[model samples]
Target: MLAFLVAGVILGVLARVLHHEPDDPSPVLTVVLGAVAAAAAGGVMNLFLGDDLTALTPWSFTSSCIVTFVLLGLLEGVWWRRP
Candidate 1:
C-alpha cells in the first residue's frame, strides 16, 4: 500500500546512504524494487522460520530496512565488489 511504498523509499535512501553508493538505483525504482524485495524477504522468513507478519508499523519499516540491506548487500557483493 501507500505506507509500504513510502516507507520503502525512505528505507532505500537510508540504505543508499549507509552504503555510500553513487546513484546506483534511482529513488523511485529503488522504492519499487524495495517493496518487492520486502515481500520476498517476508515470504522467505515465513517459509523458513515460520515467522508471520500480522501488522504493519514501525517494526515493519525496520524489518524492511533489514531485508533491503540483506538483499541489496548480496547484489552489491556479487556485482560491485571491490578488491
Candidate 2:
C-alpha cells in the first residue's frame, strides 16, 4: 500500500512534468489515476507471479510504475484529443 502510494506520486509528478500545459488535467486527478493504476498492476502481477499483493518487492514496485505510466499516458491521450 505504501509502495503503491509512493509509486503513484512519482508517476503522477512525472506525468505532470511531461505534459504540463494550460489545458492538461489536474494534478489531483492524475495522482488518483496513477494510484489506481499501480494497484491494478500489483493485482495483475500477483495473479501471474503468485506473490503477495501487499508485499513491497522490487518486481511489484517496478511493475506498478510501468503500468501507472502507461495508464497515465493513455489517459492523457484521451484527455487531449483534438476532436
Q: Which candidate is the best by TM-score?
A: 2
> Residue 17 lDDT in model 1?
63
Q: Could you say which candidate leads in lDDT? A: 2
Q: Model 2: per-residue lDDT, tens digit, 1-83? A: 77787788888888988887777788998989998889878767776788787777778778998989888998787856567
TM per prediction: 0.49, 0.84
Residue 40 lDDT (model 2): 77
Instruction: Estimate candidate 1's alpha-carbon lDDT, on a 0 to 1 scale.
Output: 0.59
Question: Each candidate: RMSD to true structure?
Answer: 4.3, 1.6
The stretch of ten residues in a row with the least summed lDDT in candidate 2 is 74-83
* lDDT score, candidate 1, position 71: 66
Q: Over the stretch 1-83, how does candidate 1's per-residue lDDT look in tens digits?
A: 34555555676666666666663655565556667777555555544554454344555546656887776666544545555
lDDT of each: 0.59, 0.82
